[model samples]
Target: MAWNTLTCAALARNASRRLHHRALSTHPNPRPYTFHIGASWAGKPNEPHQRPKVPWPADGLIGSWRDRTLARPNRTTTSKDAGEDFFFIQEMRNQSILEGVSFGVADGVGGWVDSGVDPSLFSQALMYHSHRYSRNAWAGEPEIDPTLDYEEREQIEGWEMTPYECLDLAYGGVLREKFVQAGSSTACIISLNASSGLLRSANLGDSGFLIIRSSAVHYRQRAQTHFFNCPKQLTKLPANSGRRFSRACIDSPSEADVFETKLRDGDIVIAYTDGLSDNVFPSEMVTICSLVARAGGTEEEQVQAIADRIVEYARQCMKNKNRVSPFERDAARQGMFFRGGKPDDVTVVVAIVHETS
Candidate 1:
């Protein structure tokens, strides 16, 4: 051992003194600890959990729209169907009646085709009627009313109706034609009110709409699915079916899940069917949109690119030859038929709602 190093006996004595002190201090005069729960409770009595308020833009929102629909590649050669899906948009300028903009998309349920019914017809008719009704109603058409009872309104063709009423008219037509049992459709519609800067949205089935700001999901519709194959939808109902509206359909105005949110400049709104929603995750959508927002070009061009990218992404997912689909994992969890990305009609609508200069 070096002369400067401590001896072995000295090291053992030092270690023993530290251990003795620690043992002497342990458990001496221990007291019970009390925890108060009231101060820590986030939801206190008489006070609901509050949502952080968002500051809305003062300038109005201007929208740029792009959409695409692609048929499933797996359909048999004998089938001529292009996957029943349809949509329309209305963009209005400086006018009171038709001031803002609106758009909607509908996905036809395939079940009707098996019954010899063409779901495309229903989907197209619904979009057509909705577009027409929204045009006239927003243009300050006198005949449409928010207060009119369903029965009191005329069933005639010339009458103007509110957006919800227009949906009812479409439903009644389906019933009168006895196409209710043949098939049904899911729809998601959004109308931006120029004067108030409020976005009004109506949705059915798994089809949904989402609003993104700064590439973050600000708002989204709830997907209504009873099970994997069964989703809430607008379907055939009795004429006198006093049932009116359900969460999925509007018959007599029972009720509608109308989503209202204030949109600011640079916010993006996307409405899509299960083809895209089920296959692609929201985080992926945000990533694509973020790139679109930063890509060099005019805002219009960027917006168009965003829509194209979204549709292309969904299409690629459908045709992905390798890799297990995220959708399959979901289906398995839900006890759905095991498979890959659902091969069905794909529809996507993207609107860049921003401030008008």
Candidate 2:
């Protein structure tokens, strides 16, 4: 049951059918507000690197915020060969200042192959198309007609597509042509409108997003691995679908799923690629975030500290394997193994919400 043997046609058929059903559901329009965003990226050991910068809105915020990415990393590496391919983009409506959205993405390296497609491309595509898609969806654009079903258009309720759908269409086309090697990614995006205060989110693969309130944590997870012969149900693309068309598909490519929630004052939203999650625990993440908020520094400094703690903690744990406290060792063995075992590409984006009086 190697990843090379999975069938892409069957997987695609299933995914497309699932998406057809999801599109039929009703989605709530969201309220919106202005907010600040900051992001950062650190490539895996010995690989190319790119850093995410603060994106500023094109126009003044009436009910929205914006930010843009800086540039790709200048330094290159060849060791473990794990580098981060990440992207982020923010946009505001052309006519309306009260409506806007933001998207963030990080592509995971395909197993051993270079997966011809750069990770940065995927993130950039998500950021670019998501804004476009959100604009269209909010404006009531028609979904891609799978079969040009004119009959259904009259009798059936059209599905409200998410930004992820636009991303899939755009990204899928690019990967089909450019990326010859097998690869996968975990992505998450958030769209908000100040007029309605509605927040929409979508995810795929393993990248994660977290909402932090005063005392609680709400996490949204996407993209589960389709390991060799594993039976867990995660979205996996069918085999032989991408450029190579020879490698087996593991997990079905996840759907362009969406979730809506309300935003309140004093809320903190954190989005990150697997590089950060794989090496750090959820509780530990919360602790680091709380400390950063209290200590009060630039977003970049806070982000660097969080990334450093993960790398340093993992490195230290690897060094003191035998000295683990009896109680802690057992838990560490089961849970922290991935974090301490090796260094992986790490990227984190932190946004702190301020209540406008």
**Best-fitting candidate, scored by lDDT:** 1
Q: Across residues 51-163, which tens digit of lDDT does each residue of candidate 1 receive?
A: 11221122411111111112212111222223466676654323233345656777777665544555665565566556655554441233645476544444323344334
Residues 228-269, candidate 2: write the lDDT tens digits: 212121222334555544554333334545677777765666
* lDDT for position 262 in model 2: 72
The per-residue C-alpha lDDT of model 2 at residue 258 equals 64
* TM-score of every candidate: 0.65, 0.59
Which residue runs does candidate 1 get wrong by more than 4 Å?
A: 1-82, 92-98, 139-166, 173-181, 237-256, 321-326, 336-339
lDDT of 2: 0.45
lDDT of 2 at 188: 70
**Residue 76, model 1: Cα distance from true site in angstroms:** 21
lDDT of each candidate versus the true structure: 0.53, 0.45
